[model samples]
Target: MVSMRSALRTAPALAALLLVLTGCGDSGPAAYGTDDRTITVDHGEKFTLKVPANPELGQNWYLASPRADAGVLKYRGDREDTGDGDGTQFFDFTALSRGKATVKLLFCPYGRCHSADEVASKPVPTATGTPKDSDQEAAYYLYTITVR
Candidate 1:
C-alpha cells in the first residue's frame, strides 16, 4: 500500500519544516534565575531574571543597583508580571559591553520602595531587626553577571 512517489515528495517538505522549527541553526541568548550561582552573558545578548512576587497583595520586586552607565548592562524593559496569587516578575536586560555588573533586587510591600536608589541605600532586613514574620520592611535578592 506504500507509494515511493508520495514519500519522496513529503520528505523534502518535512525537511524544510524541520529546519524552520529548529530555528535554522540559530542559538538564542541564555537565561538565569535567582538560584543560579553566577550568570555570564555575551555582549548584545539578552537575559532575564525571574523572581517571585505578589502584586495583588501590594508586594513587588524592584531593581536596586547599577544605574544605567556606558560599558555595562542596561534594563531592556519593564518587569513582566505573570501568574495569579503569588506570581513571578520577569526583568529583562541586555549586555552592553564586556564587563561585570551586579544586579540587586528588592521585594517590598506597597509604599516601601519609591525608587531604586532608596531601596539600594537601605540595609537588607535582618531577622533580629525586622523579624521574618513581621509585616514591615523588605527582602533582597542579588545576582552578579559577567559579560564577555
Candidate 2:
C-alpha cells in the first residue's frame, strides 16, 4: 500500500506536468466574418477577418483605412483563397492593447481599374477617377474591434 505522504508529494508534480502539457498546445487564431458587426479580442491574441473576394475578376478587397491613433491593433498579413476557389480573402491582425480600433476594407476592381498610387491614397480613389458617379463606386466593409 502507498503511504499518504508519498501520494501527497507526487500530486503536485503530476499537476505541474499536466499544466505544462496543456499550455503547450496551440489553439490557433480566432475567426470573424462580415456578419459579425463587432468583435472582442484579448490582448496578444491573433484573429482573422474573412471576406468574399475574387482577384481573378479584378474585384478584390484591400485595406482602405485602419485606426492610426488607437494603437491597439496590428496588421499581420493576408492571404487570397485556400485553394478552394471560394473567393475568400483572409486578413490577419493581432490585438496589441486594451482599446478600440476600426478597420475599413474597400472592394473594387483594383489593378484593372485604378492605378497603384490611387489605391494607396488615404481615401481610396474611385474606379473611373470620377467623383460621385455610380461607375466609380466601390463596396466598403467596416469592422470595429475592441481589445481587452
- C-alpha lDDT values of all predictions: 0.70, 0.69
Name the best candidate (by lDDT).
1
For residues 25-138, write the lDDT of model 1, one tens digit per residue.
Answer: 776546565566379888998888876666776667777665544468888765656576667777788999998887766767665775666766667662222213543677
Sliding window of 10 residues with minimal summed lDDT for model 2 = 126-135
TM-score computed on alpha carbons, candidate 2: 0.63
User: lDDT (0-100) at residue 93 of candidate 1?
Assistant: 88
Per-model TM-score versus the true fold: 0.69, 0.63
- lDDT score for residue 135 of model 1: 39
Which regions of candidate 2 fall more than 4 Å away from where they truly are?
1-27, 66-70, 82-84, 109-137
Query: For residues 1-148, what per-residue lDDT tens digits would candidate 2 score against the true structure?
Result: 9999999999999998998888866667988876764899999999998876657656566776544234798898888783555477888999999998888766564344342335554454433222123223564567788999
Instruction: Quote the positional error of residue 131 for candidate 2 in Å.
Output: 22
List residue ranges in candidate 1 displaced over 4 A. Answer: 1-15, 18-29, 110-114, 117-121, 125-137
